[model samples]
Target: MALTIAGCTAPPVVAPPEPPSAPNTSADLSGIKSYLLEKTGQLKQATRALKETSDRYYALAKEANFDYTALFATQKDEVIGLIQTAREQWMVASPLYEQMEGIVAGTPSLAEFDMIMDAGASKEEDPQDPAPIDVTLPDGRVLERPGNLFGVTESTLWGTFEAFRVPGQFDFNGDGQIAFGESLPDANVLKGGVDALDEQAGELAEAARAWTPTESDAFTALVVMVPTMSEYFDSWKNSRFVSGEASTQRDFVAISRLADIQDILSSLLVVHDNISPMIRGVDTAQDDAIRRGLRDLKAFVAGVHKQESGGKRFKPEEADVLGKEAQDRADAITGQIAQMAARLGVKIEQ
Candidate 1:
């Protein structure tokens, strides 16, 4: 045969095998649905507490003819306690509400949810700026509201309203300084805010119960949420927290924002745990990376609590380093999550 070969045999021309497709990790839709339901229940309970407390305060204020001094004399401690309770409940409910947005994106109710619960305007210099409180529904019906419930309530409770400047209005803490724990100057406005919050809470609960998340929706929720953690941290770094605006008084803004970020990260971890098996199957190293990143970010946040200046909160200069570190760690976690999403063939929407 060798002798008979007249020319060199041509090399076998085999088409290159198509590259293997990335592994598709099945989304934990059941887990997402259950978690959303659980959070919805918690939100309902928390909002109920808020509404009840607010109602009691409003009733007492009404009985007193909105006389702050009279109300303070009679039920100062009770009013203060209710305000504190409402604020605490709000803190718990707010983050869960945020998580629900990601889980229920692309649904019909999302627009309504945003309209009712959006916190974008909460931190504005003047959250009470007059705007159209009427919303045009999908059916073209007008839905009138007094104002944004959370923002209005926060402004009133925190004494950001001009009316709060009235002397002898709310001095619950007796420090002579009207601060967050004080009562609202106008009982009517506070009542309106409470009613709106209660209504919105009902709507949210209804929407959550009706929601049915698909596997794709679960994946979207996981992918979309990772980057939001950075947004929270960035807000802290670029806002009053870094510019020394929060150094003077007991600025709860920074603390509130930090707590919000922590809540978001913790929620993401819950979702991660729900899909841990799939993530492990795709790449254990990436999973480990994400876990480590989250741990580091949490540790950094914890360190910040120990760095408080003037026994109020960490000063701008003191927080600068830790804030940057937190942002970096959040970015790392986001990157790892993005990689995992890509491997799972989940398209992440901006």
Candidate 2:
């Protein structure tokens, strides 16, 4: 009987039930982490896409001889809209992902959650150019050229429009003010009128040369002429039916003039983007160095643009000063651009 009692089986070993799963707790937290990282990457890609698209649109607008401000404005709105949409989606998804992580780890306080997820939103609208409108003629077809500059001035086409509006008689008859009449005179007479026109054009050109844009309004008007100056080169080059080669004997003149205006515009835009980064504490000493380099480059390009175009008639001694200034600026900017390009892996000709 003792032996039988000893043989009795021991009580079955008890196993505890598995612990309850925490709400949204990932085993390794890798899933949620990966998702947040991917979302951030997507946001950056969207920003890059927006920039590429904008650059293309701007380049095309400039090529078409469109009004720069209006062209820029049109592209800017589209870019801003795209950025807003991407940001909204990123903001919504990012915080939610972080929240899930917090829940899985431990219940985080609201303030702590905000601290982890909050990069406060910034609100500002991008400035841009307005949509372009085509100018239609009597036959409902767009006019390729409006002789005497009537069609250009009639529309919002950019340039020194005031030149077209001056009151003057076509001949010695001393008629009343010559308004921008609807129709051009017959082409047969056009050749005969060249001498008088040449004289008038010379006077107008002298006025353009002498005019110094002193006030903001005058500067704006001058700035607006930049695209037209560039377009003059295009028109001279492309019109095969016209005397293209003879027209561009002074081709460099047009390029130099347009370059000056573009240099100014580039400087203004750069100051807004890169220079401000240095000033705002967004970046530090390296940024300050880059900013100084950019400033020097900008000044040089401005001088080159002015001198090349013969925009300002400088004395020989002044020309040397201007030349040195331009060279210095160009060198500085080229160096800065090279440094930046190396960091970003961008390839551009100096």
Which candidate number would show the highest lDDT if scored against the true structure? 1
lDDT of each: 0.60, 0.32
Backbone clashes in each candidate structure, one number apiece? Answer: 0, 5
Candidate 1: how large is its RMSD?
Answer: 7.0
User: Per-residue lDDT of 99-182 in model 2, one digit per residue for the tens?
Assistant: 222221121211122221221111211113211222233223442222221122221111112322222222212254532221
Q: Where in model 2 is the C-alpha error above 4 Å?
A: 1-135, 139-141, 144-286, 297-312, 315-328, 344-350
- The sequence of per-residue lDDT tens digits that candidate 1 reaches over residues 1-350 is 77568567778899999999866466555676677678778777877777777778777776777677777788878777766776676666666665555554323334345545543332233355433254332223443543455656655555555542235556666788855445453555555665666677777777767777654454455556555645555455554445444432222342356655565556566666766677787898888887777667766665554453334555555556666666667667777777777877766554
TM-score of each: 0.71, 0.26
Q: Clashing residue pairs in candidate 1, if any?
A: none
Best by TM-score: 1
